[model samples]
Target: MSSNRNDLDRARAAWRWRGQQRPDFAVTPGPGQESVWDYPRPPAYVPDSRHVSVYAGDTLLADTHCAMRVLETGSPPTFYLPPESVDMAQLTPSDRRTFCEWKGRAEYFHVTDSSGRRIDNALWRYPDAFDDAAPIAGWFACYPSQLRCFVDGEAVRAQAGGYYGGWITDELVGPFKGEPGTGHW
Candidate 1:
């Protein structure tokens, strides 16, 4: 386990874009917009007071004016809603688990709508987050691809792939990391 952890640490250290410099392909943010490239590598836990909401079809799954945005370089922000704002009954633990060197292990959840429609692994949380990521310990982040998500009344577009959970709002500009051929980014 220690060997695997060390290997993960090494891989995390090897990332090319750590937000010190933006790649040529990165989009420059217009007035109120933010460039994902400007975010940090270890990610910043930004407290966002904007109204964020998630819906599984027509059923509301989560809603909050207080949320945390995990801002990482090369990716759009992933909004994490506090547990108190989420409808816990709609989520069930999923078998899928993933590790983030910066945040520690993440556990997935399957979100189900009132109509019984289920979106597997539609949400995730870091129950035992690393020291730096401790603020989001019980917060949940949903995939916009699997559910409808909004930030301050603006609809969110899912970051270009199935794996990444970044929520792209109109105020954010990016040649985000999850797109095809961007595996190296």
Candidate 2:
């Protein structure tokens, strides 16, 4: 099948699966943190100030400033944000790195904050990227499950799904593609 056909099929299948999802739907927001139901997002991705975190069993993960918005996806909209908002004192640099054809090369990290909190390379950033996404340069981001959320010192959570990154958010939606999302995106 052509790539275009595959994309369309994937889109349709996702839409159907979403509409047919069980009302008792469940998802893991972070390690050992599971929640029921889905989170709603706005259309056309409105840039807004947000906060998010990554945690491991009641432990505070990394918290950072963010921008949240819903993007077009059969699953759910994803929130995107900048790295400066994140406190890198908790992250450890990892040799692991990859590249996005459109975004450019990305570097990863294993996190351990100044408070000694830990979350392995659950965060990533594109040191250099296309001009369009350049605003996010140097801004690190983490998966919802990798960390927890605390916006304005208030604890918040996200919808269940491994396919999302709540940038500038803790209640972000999905489906997000990390690995293998490369090649002419």
Candidate maximizing TM-score = 1
Question: Which sections of candidate 2 miss by over 4 Å?
Answer: 1-46, 51-72, 75-77, 113-117, 150-185
Clash number for each model: 0, 17
Expressed as tens digits, the lDDT of each residue in 128-151 for candidate 2 is 754645655666656655666555
TM-score of 2: 0.51
Where does model 1 exceed 4 Å of error?
1-5
* TM-score (all chains, Cα) for each model: 0.95, 0.51
Which residue pairs in candidate 1 have backbone atoms (N, alpha carbon, C) closer than 3 angstroms, thus clashing? none
Q: Give RMSD to native, each candidate.
A: 1.4, 8.6
**lDDT for residue 106 in candidate 1, whole number 0-100:** 92
lDDT of 1 at 118: 89
**Candidate 1, position 38, lDDT:** 93
| lDDT scores of the candidates, listed in order | 0.90, 0.49
Scanning candidate 1 in windows of ten residues, the lowest lDDT window is 1-10
